[model samples]
Target: MINVFFDKVEFFANNKELIKLIISNKRDKKSDLKKVIIKLIELKTELKLSFAYNHNTKDITKNFGINEGIILIQNLLKTDFFNADLFSTNETVQLISNKNNKVKIKTTEPTFKAIPKLNHDRIKKQRIFTQNNIYLQELGIISQNGKIKKDKHDKFRQINKYLETIESLLQESYWFTSGKPVTNLRIVDMGSGKGYLTFALYDFLTNSLNLDVEIIGVEFRQELVDKCNVIAKKSGFKNLKFEQGTIEKSEFKRIDILIALHACDTATDDAIYKGITHNSELIIVAPCCQKQIRKQLNLTNEMAAILKFGILKERQAELLTDGIRALILEAYGYKTKVFEFISTEHTPKNVMVTGTKISQKKNNSEILEKINSIKSFYGIEYHYLEKLLNNLSV
Candidate 1:
């Protein structure tokens, strides 16, 4: 029998015991090792997994001489996994476990040289957003000493994912036009709760990307508005401010970017309406509640079987509502995309809808017709977004 052992097995709480038993027993059985390699990859938000002692590892070790590679382990959603040549003398390994826990492991070569130290610790590359950032520190994502707070890790990752989305949007050519640099930009964020993203965006636009921009965050809660305003003033974010107001009543002369994250139900429609009316270069929203469409949905008898379940029906309504919203944006000459902004494990409502206004634009009658057809098929009599557009046109 091969005795296998894993490094840091006692420390990792998640899937740690299973991993320890597999590796610790094989450590002493050097001749029986058969060049085994273990590789762990990130699959989903909640599932942390490890692979070892299988034929897959045996075959790979036999062929490649190097047996293990661990790519992005923690926060797998945002990072990429790579095959690490653990046996190579020149290889460098980085490990990230919990924010407070870090250790360097020394190992002997060849048989177990390529085997990664099995721990809950995840290896991360250069981060898109750093804990040392002042805004992150002020936001409580990190401690005063510039270490990520244990409780705030998820919030930190969520903020990074949001920034990644914004960065991607900036990279796309649809927002840049007339072969000119976009020096002047104005952004409006509707329902900016606690203003996490609002402040981060300001920091990124001004400090990182170095763009001249003004960002306004609208929140109905006066307390949150005041708090965020104070932070902005303290941070010397001259172009960033939070205002107390509803999305519908807030006035805007011009908007380059419009963001409405987790605005409940019809409020998302209002945000979209404001974006379309102002001809915002980019519109990004993450809608929540979706109660309006759920109330109005009347599935056909044939379709009722699956949708008859209350939970399923609610989900269907949510999808239909956003799907229609995207179609409407397309009708208005905006190229739109809908995707998961973050994993459902962090927040259940994670889908993001993004639209970028484009030139060479023509009214897409086909999308409008499809919208109407979908509405009729689902027995939906009214969609708030469509009604708002129709009322405006009238």
Candidate 2:
């Protein structure tokens, strides 16, 4: 059985169609070496194998010729590894080992296509926003010489990550996938301070994805609004514009995607309320300065002991505030997720909350009961988002 598996591997490798091979499920439990990932990389004149040694905590990579790679894989499989998965452009093959040392092989259709540039340097070049991007230059994230500024490296990564998230969400969205064809998409960015991410999203959707999109960046400061508008015009983003207004006061006829990052205090709640009221398909926000819940806390139960510490109390408030917000969104018939938007090293207030509208019918009583139970445990009166939603009905 092992010889048969080796014959299959040699066939794919010799044919130059082998994409990747993952050998895992260590037979030696005490070994720190975890798994081995091998991929075919095309060099200037020849194809070579890139072997990545994944350890318990670190990873190491080395390149080898095809024959040498096969030998190394055979040696590892005979001793250290018990299972293997091989991927090609056309199909995938899995090899499993039983307790009796018998091997079983299975084949299925391919899950991913081959990427020949398997090196670390080439992987860095695959970012969504490259250094030469016009918006990166305009936003001062990159220099005129097409180099990213040292100070803006984290900002650049954050922008790319944000756009990557948006792209993934769009691919999964019902409206984007199987719904009626959309000739145009409308997006609103509430409290868009400098329009950094707003411009990035517009560029990605319109230029990269080649979709018809109209984006509005709402800012309370007229200066920022004017500045972003000028940049949009100079950048030739015709449908993108900025408006001077607060999240609470801003009005939009339609919104397909609503984004509000780093909105302070109850302002995040205001943005969520706006998205819910407009029935936006997607809502994303990174909440900041969660002081409202801290001020309203009436803790007198077992948690009151932990609430004695000012810092711990502040953190608890932030957690409860976002938790209730997610529950409230679920009550409104939206699927919700709360996670870190970026690393704490980049910014302390990095928590992000998102809601994707799933159904028109809401689970009001059930979700509300859960929300009230949480509020009661924390000795809180109400969540700001719940209040806005409640007042909307009245």
Candidate 3:
């Protein structure tokens, strides 16, 4: 029976008709893996199998040649999985096995034609925002001929990377994964300089994903705000608009996703505070200029010798600043992450701090204690984010 399944798979592979294969019902109940899916993909005129391992927490995918894919399927079916479903262009085959080692094979005509798409280059072909997009051209990231401008290549990459990060976060959310309708979704971009990322995000969510979203870009300069508003109108982005306001002084309604990139000095703290106060589901910020912490540092500990150097002191301040911010967010019921947003080659300020609201209660006292210890070790008086959050009425 197992050999029969392999033969059928091989027959489909030979004719390039195999569409997808799913293996399930893990023989080992202790395994963390839930199931595995394999799909036929054409790469550069050659057929390959894209194997996706769906685990309880995450999914991993890899590509293999047709012959290699068949071998892998056979091995998994024999050792790991008890049930398999194979779909081809014309037929569907199901192999089911019981704990008694008895196997049953069922074959039927496919309900619908399952055609594989040519995916020669996944990254370039599957970008959220394409080169020929009107917003991209209007933003000067791409030329009218649909080619990325040489000078704006890094900016283009940064925009896509930002969108990718946001997309992944949305994918992990309950509303997205459960296929629930997220109506009246509101997003705010603080310190939106020139509205580059702001426009790209609106385009991706509304046009690409078909989500009903309203985005507001807040810029301090009135001229950039007006310019962005014009581009938004010209591009037919009806739900997207910009307003002139400073991060600290701006009035934000309830925001689902709050983004503030390159907010200088304590402005990043102001953004995070606003996000928290407004009950934002996700807070994203890229901080610039750690001058606040550098001014407050008065280290007399052993690390003071190393901090004596101006550059090292500045670097330490940046690390400590973002680190404390992450801790403060965790104290406020958010799962936080701090990482590099882009390469230094593109821009010097690359670190990004993100916080996604979580339902589970965190140990606020312990988190605050750790923050205090770090502050004491560095001879720091306080973090700006801490100061802002402290003043919030509970």
Candidate 4:
């Protein structure tokens, strides 16, 4: 991959400066363009660049294959045009290369390819989804804020809150816990810290409500998993168990739903990909540290430094990380939403991404447009989720 050069020119913003670097840095536009494009894709994949981007061009020159350049007549200095409100921005760039692979415009609605659509008849046959959300009273309490209200035992009530949230999300549609058609509901909790919520989720899924569930709490430390497993068994939860595994290579199989809370840095990305590859139906992830982007912010040019302050950099990282995840999910044909998870006794890193797979093939063009735009905004590529999505699940 080739590296990008910065220009001392006074016409563009710092973010656009990077784009200018790609366009003007090299002497021979055609030869160096390929290297530059490889570099861009690498940056997108490795560094997770281009998260804040809100627009993409079909211009041949920007295509990086010695192709044509797209010409846009919009106001380049305006921020509002690329700030997501204009999802239908009319940016044009013509593809120049003719004797090559003619890239076809992707259909917005993705047809079910590998994963066969579930037999909706089975669900209709049995009204398992007609039941109400499981209210685990013995689990714990919740405060005015979404924070879990703990008892004298320090049982994190946040787990109950999370489960309740999940239940509510599921209740809006048809669902089930233990049947042949719905035989694949697995929840893997990345960074199951103290397992307080783990136990609570288990009790709620199994004891309070008679549902067959397969719950796996993933923790790096063997001691914690062992202790949690012991506690779960003692609590009479046969299906809920803890295991020792890292985010990179966990034994996640047929995961219908994933719940990740505060898996630091790239680990959150790891958990999201894990769930995605396993064909999980719903993904709920809350990230912890934004240090990775914080470092990148420090590398920002003087222009960005002047506009966005120190704290703003961190906030940008947080938004970009979660925003990129949302795009990747959308790119994969999932309906994605982002919001605050909960403000608990825990730290204040409370951004959550919820993604549910589309029931049918829907337009993916809009999702792709959103993704490309966000990527341009942040100058990032290949987020953790995108990395996995680009590769096989081995």
Candidate 5:
């Protein structure tokens, strides 16, 4: 049997185990390897992944003659360990050098040379879940650092980007007033379920960056809230906490950054309202459902023509709803931006509306007018955003 093993002298996620699994499942090993190589090339083309395997070794390595920048080990058990120089050419990828816990074999070499060693300890340290000790958290109720359940791909990506963007927004001058910078960053995540992003953000700001941040996650589920609280306590994160609250009834206070990720439709709007009401410096919303907008569009007379086509009407409703919300933010002196969080391919509805409350141009009349014009063109009335625009100060 031609045995192949991948050793982490390169990267953890790119271990030889992946090759073993692929080779085992594949119909034609060579063809499957070819596919993998092609996939690597494709990833390289897109700059999604860097080169992984190293190029040099002893006599056995010469026999294999690496493919996809990889060498197959015929007797992987005999060898104690191996490493892939994923970033031999450029130091940016990684410098891996580690032992095989199972085989008890170890190898060490310079990063660029054929002999490589992946720093498994560092790789293990990098995984957010492991590094943060999420596994130790309670079940049913998710803690701030709880292990994320599978099948939440959409939420994961959105939450990650939303948190980072808010951090970046804080650095912008528009988010400040009278040149008085908002140095003490306080953020609250409303309807914060599982706190995948909440914990992720705290990890970034507090542990990784060592920035002094006050972070809170508010969720209706008491269990999840309690779980988060425990995790916060255990992590020794004084600035992080979780509270039980609803967006509608929750009393939002002194929040510099407010985020609502996939707060179910109108709930997302409510979260936005609370942020603006509390005079939050930055508001980022990734709304999940648009059921309210969908229903309102059906009832409004102006939307009748567009409603003629169900598909067209649905798309129109989505755009109109978000557009009105954008205008409302503008009315409150918040500069709003709407963009795709992911894609329809990933999940049809991916809407992120970010707002920075600009003091001078709080209520940009031009932006408000443009939003109205868009509504008029689409015959969209009974807009939730428009309703709120008149309720609060810009």
Candidate 6:
């Protein structure tokens, strides 16, 4: 038997008919076939693909914005060599051909796709972090039967999304200088309630990304810290541990990433201050509770009518609080971004703030003036983050 792989197969212009034939007979029992995937187009904004399955029935599952790039498969004993032409902005393609006589292969550059749809069977079959993960089971995200709990479905998706974001961020060249890989990383997760995300991150960084990393999850609850430590030990995550401490009290000499998800009121500020003080490479937080700014926001003359409404005032405070935090991060020589983390259906506190430290310092007098003006206009004495950083050098 001969086997071959081709990366430059021209599908639309040449092999469309072949792909059609392959999908049409996807369920042929004699073929020993599994499935056929056809990526329709790669747009700058999204990805499109059709999955043709060959289990008990043959059906096509069309999906949009799937992140998996390409897959090629061949079965030599059955002469079932399958080649798929994956459409993309760059017109990328892959093909596998196995025959009795000879084999041939071709390769080329690869392009990235979007995250796969949730219903896609590949999500379960080829999960990057499997359901059998001991930490996930210990955390009750998955059942003892190695299945995701029905209620924890959203939680599972959130974990995957979190890992995906971190994976993409790690690929940036700025994180690695002169092609030297980062072997050691110290990550601190502030307010790590239940440690659901902390465990996922540690697993991905150590098991998936293959990085040597030490992770500390700081939670005020001693019970939770002890529980998480037990889970970490059971899962054999030697470099991953939990500590009973608040974000402000926790100290680390060196930190690579500082993460705080849904830290309440001023805790988000504490996390950011720690990241900035340690000069961490990355800081990510999904802030919750903006009462600090909301409580001090009086009905100013400029916007008394709108600010008088409770709902509007609350919404405005959330935005302003996070906005100021982003600006503060920027002024501290970190590139910052604020965006919706997830839908409100999953969690209302879904706004995520990301800060990546840059080499240049940017705490100019103008930035300070802007910060102060915003505070004064809202009648806020000090943004929690600002108050924390007032004595520290930016």
Total clashes for model 3: 0
Q: How high is the lDDT of residue 135 in model 3?
A: 75
Q: Which model scores highest in TM-score?
A: 2
Error of 5 at 323 (Å): 1.3
Q: Which parts of model 1 have CA positions greater than 4 angstroms off?
A: 1-134, 174-179, 360-362
Evaluated against the true structure, the overall lDDT of model 6 is 0.69
lDDT per model vs. reference: 0.68, 0.83, 0.84, 0.51, 0.56, 0.69
Q: What would the TM-scores of all predictions be? A: 0.67, 0.74, 0.74, 0.56, 0.57, 0.69
In candidate 3, which residue ranges exceed 4 Å CA deviation? 1-125, 129-132, 360-363
Q: Using alpha carbons, what is the TM-score of model 4?
A: 0.56
Model 6 Cα lDDT, one tens digit per residue, 65-129: 32232232233213443344333323334434333333333334424332222223443333356
**Which portions of model 4 show Cα errors greater than 4 Å?**
1-157, 176-184, 297-308, 344-347, 360-365, 392-394
In model 3, how large is the Cα lDDT of residue 113?
Answer: 61
Residue 312 lDDT (model 6) = 93
Q: What is the lDDT of candidate 4?
A: 0.51
Superposition error at 363 for model 1 (Å): 1.8
TM-score for model 3? 0.74
Taking all chains together, the TM-score of candidate 2 against the true structure is 0.74
**Predicted candidate 1 versus true structure: per-residue lDDT over 1-394, tens digit per residue:** 0011122321221332222212221212333433233433334443233444334235322111112221212112112221112222222222222222332343343322222223223322222356556667777877888788999888877877887788778666443323245576899999998888888788866776566889999999999999899889888989899999999999989988999999999999999999998888899999999999999888776787888899999999999999999998888878899999999988898999999888436466788789888899889998999999986541
lDDT of 2 by residue, 326-387 (tens): 88888888889898877889878778889999998865998888888888988889788888
Candidate 2, residue 123: the lDDT equals 31
Q: Give, for candidate 1, the lowest lDDT window spanning 10 residues.
A: 1-10
lDDT accuracy of residue 244 in candidate 2: 94
